[model samples]
Target: MTLPLSGLAFPPSREPSTRVPADLRKQGFGVRIAEQRDLGFMRALYETLRAEEMARVAWPEGARQSFLDSQFTLQHRHFTTQFQHAEFLVLEHRGQAVGRLYLLRESPRWLVIDIGLLPAWQGRGIGGALLRQLQRDAQGSHAQGLALHVRLDNGRAHALYVRLGFREQGGVEGLHQRMHWDVPTAVAQLNTA
Candidate 1:
């Protein structure tokens, strides 16, 4: 069930693909499958993602560094092994890599394993466009919705998900909140609109 790192297989779509919404394309936003050359960037971004949480632990500098290294390694291994078919995408805007998106398609749902953008790229519409595209993809399949896990302390990310129509399903592993964006409800609202 392992998908090649080049593209994703959507159930209803006839072909494997990578896409940038039309509007996003006009704004120079695009995405591509991550390759070996992108490893450093990916690891650095992962570190940046834990910066806030690492700061809150009150651990000494050496201990904090050790903790981040260990945690990052663990998380990386977990994702690669647990979701072998997931697509790892690199987000680019105006020809610069600004973020990453990891998606795993499971039975009855598409799991958004991780999505993170550099600080300068935050609040832009790239993440929203990527999500909307996923919802569109899900609607065409037997999938129920788009699901993701967001840390409870990441208010900005949590709010973004809420704004995008995801509701808290329940608590997941540790401090993560399991949220879902139901496609049928969204499509129904759109039709009504």
Candidate 2:
């Protein structure tokens, strides 16, 4: 079932700055339901994510574009179809699309289907902030915890998850590994200690 936004402590809305500031990191970030018009930007963001890996492949320009296009299409279709109740949100900073976050609420635990930011927006703690907000939302709703799968090769993201208290669960699934953050247990441990 779809989780109602009214139940969560959603981010506050802010007026977009007229001129890009020197420190854009200080700007407030918010999220909104992604729309059809965002598909192009989202697709380009996906391409940026795979750029490094794609660079390693010695393929013609047209071939590379075609491959990314097909892969993105498949992924988008799969996510939309498989997680019908999930919220597909677009991360915005100063009213500009900076990233995307897909979340699915399954009674006991919330699943992070995907979360990614543009290269320019990375390393600014925005992703972590977004996750922290989600954690709070989950806790407020009395959910058990949050869960997600991280690519085996994504050490940076895996480290972030670990730092956020997510522990590796089960074995690897293909190229990804399952990880979970159990809120009740964590809270209990913290209380006891």
Report the number of the highest-TM-score candidate.
2
What's the alpha carbon RMSD for model 1? 6.3
For model 2, give the 10-residue run with minimal summed lDDT. Answer: 1-10
Query: Residue 180 of candidate 1: its Cα lDDT?
Result: 93
Runs of candidate 2 with Cα error greater than 4 angstroms are 1-26, 186-193
Off by over 4 Å in 1: 1-16, 57-62, 185-193
Cα displacement (Å) at residue 122, model 2: 0.5
lDDT of 1 by residue, 1-193 (tens): 2212233222221223547789989988888777666666776787688887777789887777676666656776687777777887888888788899888888667899999998778887778888888888777666778999999889988888899899999657798999999877666455446
lDDT of 2: 0.77
Root-mean-square deviation (CA) per prediction: 6.3, 8.6
Q: List the pairs of residues colliding in candidate 1.
A: none
Can you give the TM-score per candidate against the true fold?
Answer: 0.81, 0.82
